[model samples]
Target: MLFRVDPASPVPLGDQIAACVRGAVAEGTAGPGDRLPPARELAGSLGVNMHTVLRGYQKLREEGLIELRRGRGAAVAGGASPGRARLARAARQVAEEGRALGMADEAILGLVRAALAAKGPPPLPGPGDGRP
Candidate 1:
């Protein structure tokens, strides 16, 4: 896996790391069942504190994108393909924006439901799907 962190960026290092992994998953460079580099190794390579990488991995774990095993390190969870990862990220962003605008959870969900209803069922994906 290719992970990069910018210590100078305003974004927290842990968040940056998590974002990189998420982007890779969204782009198909990382896929289900793939094992991530050990936290210490990644921390050494990125020149960041080991705990930072762990935090990022923990975040991904919470998102159901990865599973952390006691001695097995972290491995991408099953079913988190590029398309699903992208959708999860987009849904989170949309929820956050709605909350920032003082929308309640039910209200946001209702809007989503309305939008989905208007669009009807999504067309079956074709070969390659071509989503970004």
Candidate 2:
């Protein structure tokens, strides 16, 4: 996966690194069992600290998107699918934002349930002949 970070952005570097992997998985560029570059090496290339890469990897581990093993390094988790990775990342965002807003766990869950019950994002038009 190609990792990138904006040093000036409000988002943390580690989180940006994690986002790269997550996006790769979501877009099917990376998938289950795909081995990732060594954290130390990736850090060198990204010009960030090794621990920053590790922290990103740890976040992926917590999200069940990747696995970390001694000597073997990190690989995409066997259970991770493109859809699952995207959903997991989205869920984490919702939960984090909810917590930041001082929402209780049950309230956050309720919000999710309500959303699930509603019509979702509008479907993209396909083969349209009218609007530009």
Instruction: Check candidate 1 and list the clashing pairs.
Output: none
Q: Score candidate 2 by lDDT.
A: 0.91
Name the top TM-score candidate: 2
Lowest lDDT sum, 10 consecutive residues, model 1, at 123-132
Looking at candidate 2, the ten consecutive residues that score lowest on lDDT are 123-132
Residue-level lDDT tens digits of model 2 in 46-122:
89999999999999999999999999999999998999888988898999899999999999998997576456564
Q: How many angstroms is residue 81 displaced in model 2 relative to the true structure, after the best TM-score fit? A: 0.4
lDDT of 1 by residue, 1-132 (tens): 778888889878998888788888999999999999999999999899999999999988877888899999998889788887787688878887999899999999999976886587776556687742
lDDT of each: 0.86, 0.91
TM-score of each: 0.73, 0.78
Alpha carbon deviation, residue 18, candidate 2 (Å): 0.6
The candidate maximizing lDDT is: 2
TM-score of 2: 0.78
Off by over 4 Å in 1: 95-132
